[model samples]
Target: MWYLNDDLVDSSYHAENENQVINHISVPNIQRSQHRANLECRARNTVLISPVSKTVSIELNLRPLSVSILQRHSQLSTHTQYEITCESWGSHPPPTLLWFLEGQELKGVTTEESRSSNTSVSRLLFTPTPEFDGKRLICRASNPLLPGTAIEDFWQLRVVYSPILSLRLGSSINPNAIKFQDDVYYECVIRANPPAVKLTWYHNGENLKHTPTSGIIMSNQSLALQKVTRASAGIYVCSATNNEGEGRSNPVELKVMYAPTCRNDLSSAEGTPVIIAASRSEDVNITCEMDALPESLRFHWAHTNTVGEAVDLEPEIYTSQGSKSFLFYNLRSEEDFGTLLCWAQNSIGTAERPCIYQIVPAVDISNYKQYPNYGIKHSFSSSPQFPRHG
Candidate 1:
């Protein structure tokens, strides 16, 4: 029998009658890392050989089994089910498994485990809640192979949550161009973390004034902009940062329209005889008074049948707002008596009106000779304009 380091570790071998009795044993290494406190090793003779029995113990500075944890929970919640796997392996026997929160042991929880002929493994489960925030959780694995001999290892665990972020727009603005004097607003919203999340708003790569409000509403993440201007027309970004890391929202491009208080210098009034010649087979000159911020405006015209669909004229005429003349060279009979529509769209809205035109076959000039007293040639060169229908 022998004792090492004031009984920190011990060993013993007893033989009777020198009959080659078996009696050899070894003490494994035990180490502690920021958790465990002590390690002990001991050996004793289990059998009394005819006359004598002996035992020994030793105090060895061996390293304990290393313990680690693998978490399978992606999102944490008060009622969210999750799994935790704890594993510890060392050259020790009959290890102990323990769970802790804030350095306090959890009680009365059933534990399942497997041993590597000398190691220990355990799995535990629990629902995460807000109360778990800022608290340290740990798992310990210990081995007690011999009487009064034990070793242990431990691991730390952490929990995290997911966040939500979104953008809000007041009105739709044209991406191509903006006029002036238009009001635009941008809003950002998000669901804050348990400990809370810091949110920031940026416009056109620059931070918004008075941004980073500590808390706006119950939601930890939300932002808004008012009366958008040309400066507001740019990529907007929202970022949420916390101890866990950072989450950013999808970039949103803002377009601010220009709506000047004054009107453009263009007009289409009654008694204005604008001649429209066919520029192409499907061309039409459109004339209208437009108060466009771009100063002057052009109009486009199109002919549509009774079906409210477009039809062909002798010359196709496509006119936009502010244009006074259009040409149509290809006139299809199927498009006769169809309506012509003129529309102008700007940052505000679309200005559109329709006019009807009828196509008729040529008639003899003698049909209008009822009131002619002086001698005149009967020809189709001159014809009276058709009267408007009520």
Candidate 2:
């Protein structure tokens, strides 16, 4: 008779022609609960004396029934420390536990096991960086006795971080070749864990607003400047904001090329003439100042009379320094009295309007009468005449 843990084996078979009758019994559906069970075989010739019995203890090797990771937050912040635990049950000698990241084994992990309960546990201390986001983190369990049997619990990592920003000129623009009245733009490149919600632009430390009508068109990631002028030349920066934090880019400088223009204080209204009174045979000095990017200005002086006759002034009569020019004229005769036009030119182009000056004869003070404690009033029979040249 064969018995496995007090259960009768009805299908016991006997081998023929053996010195001692050999009985074979099969234990079906072995499980972890059957480990250390007793198996017994007994032989009785006359059913009277105590049966000779042979007993053996069964030790079963089983794979883990379940392996899982404890519930925890899926989202993690960069540079923060966290603890993750994994558990396995129903292995005979307790399964070997380990941690893995992106298919590579992780060292320095802590593990605990209980032989009485057939359970194994592993704990991993983790710290994540921005580069670790979207990678797989795994907790694997396997038994050394059972080859090629491994179970794992894995999840993709989500790491939160602040925004990173970079500011650049448009792809089609050349930093060294920008010019006035040219169309240009800037681009803001960003990288962030969470998408950026707001983007801001700055010029020379002042915040810039979106005003399309003024040639400043702004979008989420770019700024377009139409017909750029000298005033548009300055330092520019871009910034991005998200839930994590804000990030700012390095400053980019813009240089614009432009022609010379009259200085604001020296400029005159259109068609308004500046009058100069001087006597004949006297030398008068006229100065013209201009504003330009390159500051290398070329000046041209011309005289146009009331009779429509025009003559270019000799270069020897004028001196130029930087963006300013001075002309000396001697009114030796009436022909020298006329309209003086000062024209300035630079690398870009010439000024749109020339500075105009009218040369007129000075008033005679001897003909006016002065009274005590009263202002003088002069009465002349003839009006002043404008000079004519042929």
Candidate 3:
């Protein structure tokens, strides 16, 4: 008798036991099933009283397809980003997993080893365009146990971005009330997400369809408009949008200005009467009045017909805080007859006043001039010498 793996085989009555020899037992193509099947075999001599049985056990293997996205649905603006990942769960020589985008194999994928497991995962990160919206992406797991068989999952891609509507004119430039035909400039700005903002202009709260001097530009978080116009005035508003959301700017007002135009007339004063004898001293005075904001006054005098001689005056230059006058001492000749000119100038322009003077024959002489005429008094005790021309 002989035993193979705890099973017995016997040959007794029969001359040859080759016909009763047991060879092999097995469960081929094992797979997860509702019930398990046991494998057994027996070998015996032709006339042996009992036959012996040998047994073996087999277990089924299974794997499941996995689902994950490089990320959850995210916002993308023109030239913005989106990504996805495809991975699975399996054992005994990890199964092969494949990635697909919009039902097509992912063109670019980066792979890394699992840190805690014996599995490999792949990633496909990319920026999606407007053309990528409403597309389908699929992930699958492939294994040899089920040849040409695979588990699958899918996701839908979305594209979201904001669009620019209109621009708002700020109140900083135009305050109070704006006048018509006034040259003016204003600024308009708006803020939004998902970039690529476009700005438009308006007049009197109406959309501007004509030539516009300003343009809209996009910054990190805001939009700008420069050098706006009076026609660009009114309740201005700006709107910005993206796949995420939209925003608007508060209203603004504008005003303009022009040059001031005004006119005025000057009034004169009656002249005072005064006389001066030839070869004698005399004093003269003139007055002027002007009209201007933050008032001012000025005085001037000049001979009209004098021949290269200024009337001898004690104080040639006379000055007061708001007025001026002229004086002469010991006049010697009669060439001083012309006119004394007094001019007053202000912001508006210049005005003038004049005085006329005539020279009369000398009569009363000054003490200095009389001294030469008086005869020398006789000496106290001697005869006074007669005055001589020398």
Best-performing candidate as measured by TM-score: 2
Candidate whose lDDT is highest: 2
Q: Find the 10 residues in a row with the least total lDDT in model 2.
A: 371-380
Clash totals in order: 60, 0, 12
Flag the better candidate by lDDT, 1 or 2: 2
> Which stretches of model 2 miss by more than 4 angstroms?
1-159, 204-206, 264-271, 306-308, 364-390
Q: If scored against the real structure, what TM-score would every candidate get?
A: 0.30, 0.53, 0.31
Per-residue C-alpha lDDT of model 3 across residues 1-390, encoded as one tens digit per residue: 333334444322333465544353333454544113344455455664777655545334445445454555654554555456666654324566667766678677766656365455667777765555667767666666767557777777666544534343334534543343433443544334445454544445665443334443434333334443333344655454555566555555443321111111221123321222333233333232333222344444455435555443223554423323333322334554433334444443444333333233333313223334222111111222222211
The RMSD of every model to the true structure, in order and in angstroms, is 16.4, 12.2, 21.7
How far out, in Å, is residue 30 in model 3?
2.5
List runs of model 3 lying over 4 Å from the truth: 1-23, 28-63, 77-83, 91-93, 112-119, 162-390
Segments in model 1 whose C-alpha atoms lie over 4 Å from true places:
1-119, 122-157, 160-164, 168-187, 190-198, 211-222, 229-231, 243-245, 255-343, 350-390
Question: Of 2 and 3, which scores higher on lDDT?
Answer: 2
- The lDDT values for all models are 0.46, 0.79, 0.44
lDDT of 3 at 263: 16
Q: For residues 1-390, what per-residue lDDT tens digits would candidate 2 score against the true structure?
A: 887787876545566765656676777887667799888887876767898888999987778888888856768886478888888998776788888888788887899987777788898887877777888888888878999788888878888877788899999999877889999899999988898888999999999999988899998799999899988999999988888888899899999978777773344445345566567777778787777777888999999875778999999999999899998988878887778888889888898877667776656333221312212222222344323221
Model 3 weakest 10-residue run by lDDT: 258-267
Alpha carbon lDDT of residue 284, candidate 3? 31
lDDT value, residue 155 of candidate 2: 78
As a TM-score, model 3 comes out at: 0.31
